[model samples]
Target: MQRGMYESRAYATLLLKNILEVADPMHIMNLKPLVFTEVSDRISDKATKAALHILVNICPWGRNRHKTVEAGAISVMIELLMDEITHSKIDNVGSNLALLSLNLNAPYKIHSIHME
Candidate 1:
């Protein structure tokens, strides 16, 4: 059987955490638009989660949120959320979208995601 998206996201998150610890994640921040666009692609559950994990990790740093917003985080995240929830039938997307919005201070039409 295929692994679940949660497992994919968890592994992706772990790998990104390692990258952050070892390398300069500043490179990631620099490439914000391309990175966000890749996540918006949603090519696979694993890929999507990996990109989102990177996005989430990088956004906490200085000016990274601004970079993300400049990179079109709001639109990309909204598309990713809509695609995950509506098209691909994925789960746990709302949380990531909310996290991006909170980091970017992005106002969006979709709301009501609670911490659980």
Candidate 2:
């Protein structure tokens, strides 16, 4: 049954995805750390990359979806940090853009990172 499937750890990622789609600011703020930790611990690099790609593409600037993507993308960024090339190549533009879109007043601290 759907309930049983949702209860399983194996379906955690899918559940996260669904939650992300409909989550509000408070929901996203609370869930961010937990989801990041889980993705950091459980997802593979390939999955991380794919997730990042999806997050980046689906969540555009100045949209509600951007917040969801930002939360999820932060996890992908942490996971990507394990690989030198990816860590360096993946810029913080997306993060900055997401923050800007949300109208959150925070200084941009990630722009100094050199992506190559």
Counted clashes in each candidate structure: 0, 0
Note the residue pairs that clash in candidate 1: none
- Model 2 lDDT, residue 83, Cα: 54
Q: In the order shown, what is each candidate's alpha-carbon RMSD? A: 8.1, 9.0
Give lDDT for model 2. 0.42
lDDT of 1 by residue, 37-115 (tens): 4344444555555555556656666566666667675576567677767665555675656666675564322123321
**What 10-residue stretch in candidate 1 is worst by lDDT?**
107-116
CA shift of 60, model 1, Å: 1.7
Error of 2 at 89 (Å): 12
Please tell me which predicted candidate would have the highest lDDT against the true structure.
Answer: 1
lDDT of 2 by residue, 1-116 (tens): 12334235435554555556566644544443334434433354444443443343234323424454444555455445545545464456555345433333232221122222
